[model samples]
Target: MRDTSTSEIENLIALMAKLPGLGPRSARRAVLHLIRKRALLLTPLADSITEVAATARECLNCGNIGTNDICPICEDNERANGELCVVEDVSDLWAMERAGVFKGRYHVLGGTLSALDAVGPDDLRIPRLLDRVPAEAVTEVILALNATIDGQTTAHYIADQLSGQVRLTSLAQGVPIGGELDYLDEGTISAALRARKEI
Candidate 1:
């Protein structure tokens, strides 16, 4: 292997390995692939990354990441459906978008409140969420938090804060569509049963 201190490609591989869900081996393979496909992939990917690095900024309204201060979703007038989905992170918001079912706006809390990590309401975008409720004319605030202890705690706190203000709801927990019942955890099974709807 070439000395990393002297290799520009090695430096790129090192930085790539630091990204989430990537390791040294995967980074090495990816870097090799990019180098081999420089015209088709590498140059374009590099240009795109540089562009995003220069222009990406958080949406002032709902905390969604976009090049503009207000993201395209927030700028759309047709999406003003009085339904607001509150999520923990931009990734979760993106996941919801990929599903293509929801037609309303979203609020990204940035992160959940965690006692172990010393995160509080002030640390997250809780206050901003409250401010958005009235400003956006939100009729429903759906807490689509992860099914973790910290996630649940944050949900309960937000529920309390917005109890009487607007209709409060949460994302339904259940088994995945193709998941085997026998392989499901007890908590998941219980939630699935409770969330059952009439056919």
Candidate 2:
């Protein structure tokens, strides 16, 4: 059977496939769906994407993506509680914000320390974080990095750098709230045991 998809449609599918968690098959299905709902979905989505592409920029203070120089979180004076949460990426910062628990400001590292990838402190926003500590009068820093080896390494590097300056803490690692012990890996079990708190 001769190929029937136009070059433009194929290009759109290819672009969509490049997005995280999307494969060629999924992108194809999504493209078909969008085509069917052109008036309701495709045109609006295209306009939104174009707008965001034109206006989106990284926050100068914390590296969060926003339309302005500084993000709303950074601009909010109420969030300046002298407690800074350091995360590996804007996505992690957003996750913390969704929880609505931490009222302090954030510092996005952009990425973790990866020796394998030759990503060092200078490559990330470590210098900016260090600057923010004293400039913002931060009293505590919560390291909310992932449990990956690189993330832990980055957390340690930041901790060492900020030692004797402020209180430092890290997110506890363990089995999830509803995770079954039998289904968990040994590493998770060990971490859970080590991070156990008084009931």
> Which candidate comes out best when scored by TM-score?
1
Model 1 C-alpha lDDT per residue in residues 1-199, reported as the tens digit of each score: 5575568988898999999999999999999999999999999999999999999999999999999999999999999899999999999999999999999999999999998899999999999999989988999999999999999999999999999999998987899989999999999999999989999
What TM-score, computed on C-alpha atoms, does each candidate reach? Answer: 0.94, 0.93
lDDT of 2 by residue, 1-199 (tens): 2366488899999999999999999999999999999999999999999999999999999999999999998999999999999999988998998999999999999999998999989999999999999999999999999988999999999999999999999987888889999999999999899988999
Taking every candidate in turn, the Cα RMSD to the unseen true structure, in Å, is 2.0, 2.3
Give lDDT: candidate 2, residue 176.
87
- After TM-score superposition, the amount by which residue 68's alpha carbon in candidate 1 deviates from its true location, in angstroms, is 0.7
TM-score of 1: 0.94
lDDT of 2 at 187: 94
The Cα local distance difference test for each model comes to 0.94, 0.94
Clash pairs of candidate 1?
none
